[model samples]
Target: MVVVGAGLSGIAAAHYLRSECPQERFVILEGRDAIGGTWDLFRYPGIRSDSDMFTLGYTFRPWTSDAAIADGAAIRDYIRATAREEGVLPQIRFGHRVTSANWDPATARWNVEAEREGQALRLTCRFLFFCSGYYDYEQGYDPAWPGRESFAGRIVHPQHWPADLDYANQQVVVIGSGATAITLLPSLAAKAAHVTMLQRSPSYIIALPARDAIGRALQAVLPRKAAYRLIRWKNILLSSALFQFSRRRPAAMRNWLVRQAQARFGPTVQQRDLQPRYDPWDQRLCIAPDADVFRAVHSGRASIVTEQVARFVPQGVELASGRVLPADLVVTATGLKLKLLGGARITIDGQPLQVTDALSYKGMMLSGLPNLAMAMGYTNASWTLKCELIARQVCRMLNHIRRQGLDVCVPVLDTDAGQTRPALDLSSGYIQRASGELPRQGSRKPWRIYQNYLLDLFSLNLAPLRDGALRFARRGETPR
Candidate 1:
């Protein structure tokens, strides 16, 4: 068995795989020198998770910290500890980047090629699990603006935040309105002379820090398992109710959210820039604590510029509305480009697999693929929850194969109905651009990815192993 990636999801998958199949030979391949993939990579100022740590942290291991919103270092430490405690570190091979993988129908195994420390290596395995996350770790979205090179000022992407770059007392212009933009604005406001958030469009912003007095009290009183369960359920319910309410009665949700934003900015600042045109939840809502960004704006530390970038001038940026914003630094928080299965080049019997042409089975397995599965999490909820459930299901499938002497398990999608589904309803440019390459969820159970945790838990974790859609057969039992 082979696992690609050594991040939280990858480590979790390996941990579970070890527990279930202790005698099986397996190895984890990580491209980086260390574990904690995203946590180690992203080191921007004020970097932290948008979601609460309770739900974001693993269920098997509880996060016993006072701060619900943990910094990058803390999260990194937690992941490292989990890996060490679970004995997953010994099975990982660092500095290994998988280039491509091919399936051999005759041997019923995968032949994977990887580059490790500038040398090519090959491995054969019966199962290949990909946990390499969605974003491009090498280079973030650095769009080719007209005069990006001509700009005399320093420019940076959040993905590669310089360790020694100074922003003190300098005017900073942050480009984009996604989570990174919102996070950067508040932190930069305290040190920079002034910060301007340039947005092509508005994003839904909500405010709630991870740690509150109430949350701490609950954690102290309840057992670790019970507390984690309570917080997970709480977040799931709260997020779902808000999302459903926004969808059902968008006007009301929009008005309430806007009013909250206005209240944070006070009447004067509200008139200038607190109003957003689109309905609430039209895009993924940005979360903060008590409208922190709005407060920064009201305090005259930060401001928002709602205009398209006409071009990049030597001094700064020119707007489409015939305005120019001068800055000493420009941070492009534009967005990410989603890559299907971490851009792994996949082929079966010498035929390449175009992700866009394939249909998803149970949002995990791809159609026409045998004995292979990928972990894809929810866009609406914490990624770890979905990943853990999928890991469990994969284990069950593996167990069934071992018990029944089966060499292959394939998930076949029903194409006879002539129906299709969209991968996501997000308006983010990255998601929109890569929608074709992404997988679609089914309308029925097991195939559908219910963003809700309780429903997915019952369907994925607790459900019976035998299902009609999934086909398990011994070698030579089915025609290849």
Candidate 2:
């Protein structure tokens, strides 16, 4: 088995693979030299998980920290520690960027091509697990503005924040209303002369405490592992309830969210700046730890401008309403560009695999793809909530295959499965932009990604392996 990436998902996959299939040899391949994936790559002002730590952390590994909302460095260290403890770090090939993978039916193996430095390397594995995240780390999504070249100020994307670039005492303008923009406001406002968050539309932002008091209380009485388990489940239930509430009663949830912000920002904060144009959960809700963004806004250190950018001038962005916001620095938090399997080219039996043409099977494996699985977290809930389940499911499937003496297992979509939907139901700009490039999801069970953790818990983790959609075969035999 070969796992790609050394980040949270990869590490979790490695840990599960080692424990479940101890006799099987495997290796983890990471493109970057570092151990952490997104946590390591993103070094913005205040990089942190939008989800609570308990749910985000792996089920096997308990997050011991007090901060439910941990910073990027802490998350990175946690993953690194897990890798070290699992003893999989030594098996990882850093700097190896997988470019292409081709599965050979005759040999029942994948011929993988990867690049290191300027040279190419090759390897073959029976099973491949892609844990590389769904975005490009080299560059973030930065749209070409009409007059971006004319701007004299330093422009930086959060994905590529410079280490030496000093923004202290400089007027800064951050464009976007996503999690990235919300995180940057509080952090940058502490030192920058003034920070302004400019957004074309509002996003639902909720403030959560940095520390989990209930979790802390549980830790004081129960065993560390027990407390963690309790807290994790509690969070899962709460997150699910919130998502269900948003779906069933969007108007009420929207009002509650706006009121929550109003309590923090007082009456002066405009409704248009906090009230989203779309329903809650349509796009992800931004988290403001301890109401930090609101505190910054109320303190006059930061401000929010709800408007579209007309063009870039020498000073700052000129609003479509003819308002010029003067700034010494500009940060584009415009969101990420989604990539399927980290943009790696895949082929099976000399036939090119167009991901968009394939149906997503259980959101982990693609239709008719043998011995392959990907770790993609839930868009509606904590990523690790679904990722941990995926890791466990892959491990279970691999063990079952080994026990059954099967060489290939592929999820074959039935033509009668009914209508297909977009792979993701997200209305986020990033997801919508990449809709044509991602795989499609069927309208029925096992062939569609339910997105709900509870439903996925049964389908991916506990469901019977011999589902009608999945086909298995021996090394020399064709799948029946």
TM per candidate: 0.95, 0.98
Give the lDDT of residue 197 in candidate 1. 95
lDDT of 1 by residue, 112-141 (tens): 999987899999988888888777788887
Worst 10 residues of 1 by lDDT: 267-276
RMSD of each: 2.0, 1.1
Tens-place lDDT digits, model 2, residues 1-480: 889999989999988888887877888889999999999999999899899999888888889876899999999999999999889978899999999999999999999989999899999999999999788877888988877888989899999899998999999999999999999999999999999999999999999999999999999999998889899899889999999999999999999999888888886579878878899999999999999999999999999999999999998899999999998999999999987787789999889998888888888999889999999998888888788888898888888888988889888876666688788888899888888888888888777788689899999888898888888899878775
Native-to-model Cα distance after best TM-score fit, residue 315 in candidate 1, in Å: 1.8
Candidate lDDT scores, in order, read: 0.80, 0.90
Any residue pairs clashing in model 1, and if so which?
207-288, 208-288
Instruction: Sum up the clashes in candidate 2.
Output: 0
Best by lDDT: 2
